[model samples]
Target chain A: MVQAAAVAPVPVPVSTEVYQRLQHFYARQMQSSDDLDVPAWAGSFTEDGVFATNAFPEPITGRAAIAAHCDRAFAAQAAAGIVRRHVMTMLTAEHAAGDGERIHTRSYVMVLETRRGQKPTIYCSTLCEDVLVPVDGGWQVVRREVRRDDL
Target chain B: MVQAAAVAPVPVPVSTEVYQRLQHFYARQMQSSDDLDVPAWAGSFTEDGVFATNAFPEPITGRAAIAAHCDRAFAAQAAAGIVRRHVMTMLTAEHAAGDGERIHTRSYVMVLETRRGQKPTIYCSTLCEDVLVPVDGGWQVVRREVRRDDL
Candidate 1:
């Protein structure tokens, strides 16, 4: 008969495959130049997801509010007739334990803002904090917190 | 005979367990106010870990230099009788895939400095890019990069 090991079980390390997916996630989100799909972005979260920003007093919860906020921001940018690009580096991802459905991800993001007739000016360096939860579709962000880097 | 059917293997979601451990990692390194064991802290990374600051021109590599730098900082504070404390908040962690080791992590940290006489002040809000690798003992850092929030 085969004998079972007596030592305590150690936690399994995160796989490289998961890490690659996370990198892809950031590349899709922060590196994109085109306007983000508000509803699509917001929908990439749990039903009761929360979106918090340094600019917001409180977090916007649920898909509807999150989508509305994104739409508003995009609309404001449209009115200004400015094209903005966000570049991010120094990205990282970590998985949450137990359920295996949650992840904590962070990255350094620099936003480049350029108007039709003005030179491109970079805004504040920003950090993207996300809590991702896996659902039926795929891994989606349940909570997102954006904090401006202190200059 | 059992019928043979082709089943496409679905990629399992990222593990939450790893994420929880990462939360602990952040709580320990970034948020802890108590005196940390510099040697052990340095041991958290691989032998050739990288530590960089905007205050410095080049990145410090290896555990020895990393530990030395920490020791110097601690000693400086003690010698100066500054009674200083480092407060870190707005911390976020992400998994790094650049190397194969799962010990790689990156984060954003807001450092608040409190001196004996002066009012609590902001030291620097920057991103912490760390690479952690598992060793014979436990997880250790591989490489670390810090991107300042400001220009």
Candidate 2:
């Protein structure tokens, strides 16, 4: 008979302050429409943070890569004559492990993009999955996964 | 000259421990497939917490209303033989001013409900906008505003 290993007890929960920090970080990120503060946006994460967007096939890692991703995103929207508004609502966030710094967060995102001469607003909606981490600037999104809601 | 009240200096950000505690608290609240722990959940908010759901017309205020709202939700789901598996992904949380306890948390939620019979599973996806605060139990969800992702 094989000996059974003892199961460790669950880790104590995270504090409320930490949670609030994360919330504020995201609020600013989403609320930023045009002329977003690039450095501030990137500063939300650790130096070696990761960011994933719906447009990319995989995640973009590191602060530099994350900043670059945002740059391209903003540029593309500008070229398309599209003004995009990202609204994050109905959120649920959780910890991946007892002592882990990563948090799994979920929310619905409605992207309203208005282009020149378009009568109705072109809208895209999806569910966003993100990994949040505590960093020097409070809390920032380290990884984001987006799934289309309709499909 | 009426100058905009010299923009007040930004308040110091919340600590990382507070963010972690909140993540853990949400993780625990979501672990259940049954009733929501309102008392434990309400404890996560400030004295004047705001609670909102996708189905409700107006926001519910205070701990008692929050508890009532959660209780009603759990009871309704249990009666329907519907199991709720709320998965939160792509989260961003941040701290805000006032009372030193308010935070805005946003994330994507892929909600699934399964029945005993061979019926097709029901999936309702949305974004969760939560108001969280620090309490004796670490962090609690004072308000949850669920918004549907327009298909």
Candidate 3:
């Protein structure tokens, strides 16, 4: 009898359905933010979801806090005569080892900003890592960590 | 007796697997060009692929022609003392009503440009449409059309 070698199991790529749904999830979530629809974007996260970024020192916990953070930020941008758009791409998703309902995803994101009568600028570039879960027949972000490229 | 009403079949969304694969495809294809890997990027098209854009009056058809066009353009950018990056997002994919092997996709694209010691700017923004087919186990572009959002 031949001895079998033990191999480590790597995470499988998410199904086509799951991958596409996540893409749509990100798109809608980002769009809502760009459109200044605070409730819409904030609702993308779970009630107790957390958002952390290198740009800010503190992690924002809970959907309500996330909404408040975004509201203030959007207000500041609006007061500065800036128009903003969020673009996300380069997404890769895989299933978690023991959870069929959980997925890990990484994406590249950029924020485009334009002032009146000015050329659009690449305001920021960041790498976003997210842990997602299925809730209420849709995907929700449980945790998000962002690392700014220019920082 | 009730007569059945005619229902038009709207294009169905492509499978999740296809959507994810295409996202990878575009990322690799665009990254090659941004890296000045001309041949690598050009291989993304079929032998008789067609790329048309509103910015150019003539469409570049065939793999060789597309490669030449890209080569010349990349060279020009290199000479201009600037670095360029391509970011594509907001992708939507649907299947044609009558074709199982064909997929139609639309995406938003932006070219980010930076000169030495200068801030990065959005050089162009466009809407890109592509007709895709699976060839030899991977996806290839059969046709593409681009409309500049800023123009």
- Judging by DockQ against the true structure, name the best candidate: 3
Lowest summed lDDT over 10 consecutive residues: which window, candidate 3 chain A? Answer: A1-10
User: Higher lDDT: candidate 2 or 3?
Assistant: 3
In candidate 2, what are the lDDT values of residues B1-151, reduced to their tens digit? 2354455434344456655665566676666433456666555555677866655688888777776777887888778887767666545566764445676676655565668775544265556787666556566666678865433
Compute the DockQ of candidate 2.
0.08
lDDT by residue (tens digit), candidate 3, B1-151: 1333345446777767777788888999889989998788778889999999988999999999999998899899999988999888877788875686788887777888999999887787666889988888778889999866444
DockQ of all candidates, in order? 0.05, 0.08, 0.22
Instruction: Give me the candidate number with maximum lDDT.
Output: 3
Q: Model 2, stretches more than 4 Å misplaced?
A: A1-151, B1-6, B9-13, B32-48, B117-122
Model 1 per-residue lDDT at B43: 66
lDDT by residue for model 2 over A1-151, one digit each (tens)?
1333245434334456545655656656775533455687777666777766556677778888877877887888778676555667677767765547777778888765545444224267888888777666456666777787665
Cα lDDT of model 1 by residue, A65-121, tens digit: 877877888888888887878765444566664545567766555566888889776
- What TM value does the first chain of each candidate achieve? 0.80, 0.72, 0.91
lDDT of 1 at A114: 84
Off by over 4 Å in 1: A1-13, A31-34, A117-119, B1-41, B44-62, B70-151
Candidate 3 lDDT over A28-141, as tens digits, reads: 677677668989989989999999999888999999999999899889988987766678878999987667678899999988776665667778999999999898767889
